[model samples]
Target: MSLLLLVDDPARPDVVGLRSLSDDGTLLDSSEVPTDALPAVARERADRPRWVWDDTARRYPPLLAAGVRVERCHDLRLCHAILRRSVYTQSSALAQAPPGPWDGPRDPAPVEGSLFDDVGPAAVADPLEELQLQLAAVAGSDEPGRLRLLLAAESTGALIAAEMHHGGMPWSVETHDALLTDLLGPRRKGGRPAKLEALADEVRTALGQPALNLDSQPDLLRGLRSAGCDVESTRTWEIKALEHPVRDPLLAYKKLSRLLSANGWAWMEAWVHDGRFRPEYVPGGVVTGRWATSGGGALQLPASIRGAVRADPGWKLVVADAAQLEPRVLAAMSGDGAMAAAGRQADLYQGVVDAGIVETRSEAKYAMLGAIYGATTGPSAVLMPRLTTAYPRAVALVEAAARAGERGDVVSTWLGRTSPRPDAAWQAELAAASAEGAGADDVRAARRRGRDWGRFTRNFVVQGTAAEWALCWMAALRRRLLAVDGRPHLVFFLHDEVMVHSPAAVAESVAVAVHESAVEAGRLLFGETPVDFALDVVVADSYDQAK
Candidate 1:
């Protein structure tokens, strides 16, 4: 007897609609509610209804602001993306239907200082019809249970992304400013940092080009070559290998420059406000199911400024991340007993050594990573045989996926997310290379492209599945945290790590919730199969301290 409540706005700051449905997509009731009364109406039915909305970020924010929170939702946009690409639902009517307005690119979710603000909401016109279409598609899938779980987890991720943005990550402006001043010297009104300018001076002098602009790559490269440096590129790795006076200071200058440009004073001013950092997150933006941030560097928070992620007074930050996520996912998906056993310990690499797979932990790690990622050179290739012999099932799984990729076939994640088919240009290359009079160069080019695709597929299966596991982990954690006695809210989520902003009194409970949710995630994904997904949880005053 689940209730499906379809929500849509008829006009901005005015009329909104709420249509209720029974379990089988049958319309049970319909009502028009004013925007101002939405919170009260939503709160009354929040406990029993599954809120169906076009977009969570757009619809849920105002409800959250008005002190109303719904327990579950079916975000049509997020779930539509899942079903569209899912292999299990490829033959469904929803998959074969003509593209509609829903196929348009999503406007990036709003952040505090975003230029692209969300327009006032208007009626979607057919929220009930869209939900029914989605239901039919889910029913048509071969693995309905699996696809349902995937959709649920994905929608939960959407909700969490919005909620985390609304709550914001606790930040300390004073600490952030102090650290910036100490490293780069005082903030400049219309110029570069003091320390950065000095390093730039050394880089130019060493290259023997007094007026060289370090910011311009071509100018800097030409200067280096003219001064007897055999560098082909100005990239950091290439620069590091060169034996020249400009190497050290140039590297220092680049590091400091990135820090100054990326997260310096201006960044703080734009992103951090009211003692919190609010960034707009785009869930499932990456083809591999990873999240992409629209602004504020949420995914790439530099380690130098982690101390600014301080908890509020009388509160603590519980930070935790999965240990060796991809490899563990590989073992579970492949059902490799040896590989799974090797992950029994906290450090999977060390466990491989203990299982006699390699002589050193480093070798074990290199070999396993090489196996899944299709590496064929360096230490990876040197140690590949030992890894393959030790864990044939795991190696064979990726090998099969690679072979499928070489044949231009599709591959699916552990759930149902499918790898996109080769594009028109790529297929043309393959066809032209197979034609009767094709030249050696054409054949070689096609082979190279095929191998590249193979490598992509080999890694895609593992990485994408790991992302699904992460969503599940976060979903379970969210539920447990909400159910706990004291209020503890999720503040930040990277792919594998999460930070909870909770009162110090509930910090221990939050840690327990973290461990329990991880266990629940493993159960939900792999069932009783005994592959461990270990997490390192710490309670501290700041993110850096927790680490």
Candidate 2:
């Protein structure tokens, strides 16, 4: 049934079942003999387990001699499988076991009403208290104006609630009043402005009016403008909803509404640290040096979330975005004079057409993009031959890099970020296939793969460079904000969007700083590239209505 080998060294002959070798190099069950007889037996066997006499054990004239060692083949796969099975069995048993006292605390009783069911009265009241505490702390700080601005930001939250209520959505009256007070209150060293009562009166003026909320009606916009607020559009972009068939669009809408509600809760929680909502700023989060969201989903905020950003008593947010950033980046990298010149004028794609690179602006745009990205198929494929003929140097560089990568070499970004190389297994597979009568077609496919890899490597250089530009922009903006003596602090940042809280007096200055920072960022990144990174700005009383 089983086999066991035995061996003993002649130097110590007092061990049991000691033998040098076994017949056929396989040791089966053998006779148990006296300790002194072990060495003699082991010397006759072909393969045996080794044994040494244990002098430390005094009793071992020995019933069974010790110091025997078993040796077997070492295979990780077999070992892993054995361990995995044991773990699975244990986990399954644990899962079936009765719940312990420490499993979790009991859930609270569910509330009445659909909107208020999950959220309790305490939940509705806590945010207002939190805002009060935040304002109190900020007011007591050296920068009193900073606290006022934070309070102003809190008002935007009120606007969101008001908008919801105006749409006939359910909300508690206490919560609504709390939000309104936070919004209309004076945000300065002094208490609420004498005109604040008037402002509050104006806000309440729309309370019973149908379609006066920020979303359904543009009344809030008019009100803010009437109140001397300056508002403009920042950036306009379309969001294409994902296509998924649903039984009821209304149900889907409700689900989305609930999701936004949950997102709001999370956003407020993460943002309200230190009595103010200050989210983290991740510089160079994207490959293009644009900012990334670390928390509160600032960049990925839904349309509803935008309604909550508002200008402080005297401050406005100056928002801007680069127009056609990627194409400009491509032009700069390729050093195509015509493309660069066209970008400098108005449209880089049109510039290509003017240079006779293509018949139309659209074709030039696609073909040039395809070339940079190493797209040699589809519509891009049709233009490849023409692109190569027109811009051989530019095309060759990316193509050659792609070829190198397909050949199993690592590629690096402009800033020295290297792509990982193929592992030994991959190399071995390729080598084996090449040896097995792999024809020209096989070789050509390999080269094509390499070329694509090179294209990725080449683009990484450009994209990474762009990312650096964005970091410089943010850092410059932060520095400018800090340089100003007033207390309007930078609070939130999405890729290209920055929110600042400031007193009404210095809001325009803060806007100026934001604008100057953009210019400085451009200079820092491209030096004197003869191109501008223009930003569109918007200032509003509420985040959603800013545009």
Best by lDDT: 1
* Winner by TM-score: 1
Residue 160 displacement in candidate 2 (angstroms): 28
| Candidate 1 lDDT, 1-547, residue by residue in tens | 4765646554554878777787667888888878789899877863477788888878888988888777788888778777877889889877887666455455554333221222334434366777788888899888888888888888889889889988999999999998888888899999888988899899888987889988998998899899998888989999899898899999999888899899999899999999999998877777778887888899898888899999999999999989998999999999999999999999999999998878998898899899889998999999988888988999999999998888788898988888877888999999999999999999999999999899989988999899899999999999999877668999998888989999999899999999888888888888886789999999999998977
Q: How many clashes in candidate 1?
A: 0
lDDT for each residue of candidate 2 in 1-547, tens digit (9 for 90 to 100) = 1223233335555544422222222333444456655434444546533222111012121222332211211111111111111212223322233432212211222112111111212211121222222323333443344223222222222222122112211112333223433433322333333234343334435333333343222564454344443543111111012121211322333334344344434335445432333333333233222344344455565554454455544455555455555556555555655455656645666766787778987788788778667776887779778777766655665666566666777543322223445557656655755786888776666555556556666565455445444444555655576567675555555444555555666667877887787677566545666555555555555555555
Error of 1 at 80 (Å): 0.9
User: Each prediction's TM-score against the native?
Assistant: 0.95, 0.46
